[model samples]
Target: MYHNTKLTGMVVYPNDPEYQQARMNWNPFTNAFPIVFVFAQKIEDVSNAVKWARENKVPIRMRSGRHALAKDFSQTNGGIVIDTSHMRNVTLDKKNGIAKVEAGIRVGQLVRMLAREGILAPFGDSSTVGIGGISTGGGITAIQRTAGLISDNILAVTLVDANGEVLQVNACENSDLFWAIRGGGGGNFGIITSYTFKVRTAPSKVGIFEIIWPWNQLNEVIDAWQRWAPCVDVRLGTILEAFSKANGLLHSQGIFLGPAAELEKLILPLTNTGSPIKVFVDEVTLLEAIDFWAPNEPLFDTQNTTWSSTWVKSSLPEDGIAAIRTFLERASGSESNFFFLNSGGVMNQIPPQETAFFWRNTRYYMEWDASWTDKCETQKSIKLVEQARLQLKPYITGSYVNVPDLNIKDYGQEYYGDNFERLRKVKERYDPENVFNFVQSIPPAHICDEKDIDD
Candidate 1:
């Protein structure tokens, strides 16, 4: 009956000349050889791809920017990848202070477009991460404490459900679905085509700061940052990173919605905590700050990347700091490091259980990133991150669904917290057949009760 929704996307099969480029994933460590790839250009293209995959008995993997962090999350061997990468479009409503953004638009492109109009929203550090993933996964950014998460800003979404039916989800309609989509993770309940987000006018100028210290200052820097970052002024949002010993550096940077002198005073405790080799502070327009944070060229060019993130409820103890030093000392790859995105302030003002993003009260977000240029070092690189995660397990509780780790035993609870059960119920209501299945996807209540046989 729905055959009229024919597949109109550009399909690239295994034999296609561009197949290699088409199949590349952001985390090359988890690359897959899908049977075919569909670069969907419109909502009809997405609907047809989903229906065709179901009819053909081919597993479906919905990808926004190929940035899924774990194995088989966004790409699957012998299955079809229905990608929204080509569907970049946007409609701004300055009157309502909102925007209708296509799911496939990259963060950098979207930020630039909004900056041109003197508006912006909460976004992640990597300019290449797709808006669909970042928004649904609960975006992290330098302005999070001041602006709130990207999901918190979402007003509505137009998504195609697993049954080839498009639904409008928002606060007043399909409200349960809206709550689940906010932070339940991307490509879970459905494939969102576009999102209506609350956008704010960009500040003409904001203070930015960057500081670096010698590798030996790891303990001092982490101790100072974790103690100060989450409690600092509400106008500031920052990140602390400890590079591998081979790299020999500790970097901290942030965006402050204030003047340079004001930020300088706020960060004095941190700047004075450790012996910093480089310290710089300046005031720039919001657009300039975005550019300063982003890479000059497009991102996702790195290969063989392994990444995972967790919710930090409290400060990491001294033992935790030592563990990081120990791991970096012998980490196999030069790209291994620890990343901490500040939390608290306005972001934590919202209570948990309000939305699917249950880690609203987290002190900070921690991530382990490991990369290797040589393929032979893959296991070593991944293991280094794994070892680090195990060491910090006591200090960290939940994991970010965006940076999935297959090694986690019970991912449902880890990712969704108590909201996991609620998410399952929503899944049953919208996708009783469990059509959108991934490695760590939330299974409907029926499937959880052992009444199902296949994914």
Candidate 2:
């Protein structure tokens, strides 16, 4: 029913030589085959593609860096994929301290680009993740405690709705849509073509530290971290990762906005209690620290094939650190790990109702993940992740939308909390037909009974 001749963008069909390259996602576990992949080079091209999909009654999947953990939301079988990978362009208004970034630009590329101009934007830890996806889903980074979430810096967004109408959303214009897209998660409201963000001056130097403790010291190290990291100087942010017994690694890493001496003094409590095997702390340029936190990966290399089927569940760690230790003890895969991201300071300053991201008061955000190479080990890895989620449920406040898990039964309430109704209303306003939909996407509230909701 769809015709390639009617499409404006570069369309790659199944028979095209570059179809597989265009359709590949970061997660190899995704088996969905798109009917066609449209590489949108301009905003008009995106609008044209959306119009084409609507006229042909085809499901549309919007993709940028293709790093979505829940690939079902970014790819679809027998559906059209409107990929914005070709629309990467970044412009900065140095005088105004604002940057206009295209949707397809990777976070690492943006960081490097911004660094050249002595500017910085808040982003996730992954170098290859698309700014479009992360910023729309409340991007958390090493500097979040100091700088706030990536969404918080967003001044405006240009989106193409289901009707193929291009609308610029900001505080003064299309204000409601602006609020929803800030942290409502991507591919729900519409296809965001570009974002205008309020950027900050990059610090001349930042302190970076890494301390590794043996598995036996997990409890002591984690307890120290929970008590100290979140409440430390707002200029500091930390992450704790507990690798499986197969890897036998428990490490705590952080970046501080000030010099190494200040960071050393503040982190003394963490260093003294854990009996760490190795501890390294030093001051480096902001760019160097960013690279240290998240190293870059080759964008189009499928030969090595690093594939992971991941399930993530998040919560505020109160009494859950012990349960996390138990899960890590029982973890079986070579790459299974439990990650905790320190969340307080500037991140907590934002009230929960301001944006769709509701876990503002959380001290630390925890994630349980499993990764494997062999398909034969898939079941075991997924089961481990599931078991960890079930055990930690009692201690967790809610889950993060960026690290999505299909196993979540009440995804809307769990991800958005009390903000689901407002998000649904926005979805209804922008996409009344529900053309932009996925397994865990917000459904318009009028369609579902309010009594059925348990948030």
* Local accuracy by lDDT, each model: 0.86, 0.81
Provide the clashing-pair count of each candidate structure.
0, 0
Q: Write the per-residue lDDT of candidate 2 for residues 244-288, one digit (tens) a residue.
A: 777888988898889999999988998898578999999998789
Off by over 4 Å in 1: 1-6, 449-455
Task: Give all TM-scores, in the order shown.
Answer: 0.96, 0.93
Q: Which candidate is the best by TM-score?
A: 1
- After the best TM-score superposition of candidate 1, give how far the Cα of residue 61 lies from its true spot, in angstroms: 0.8
Please give the range of 10 consecutive residues that has the lowest summed lDDT in model 1: 446-455
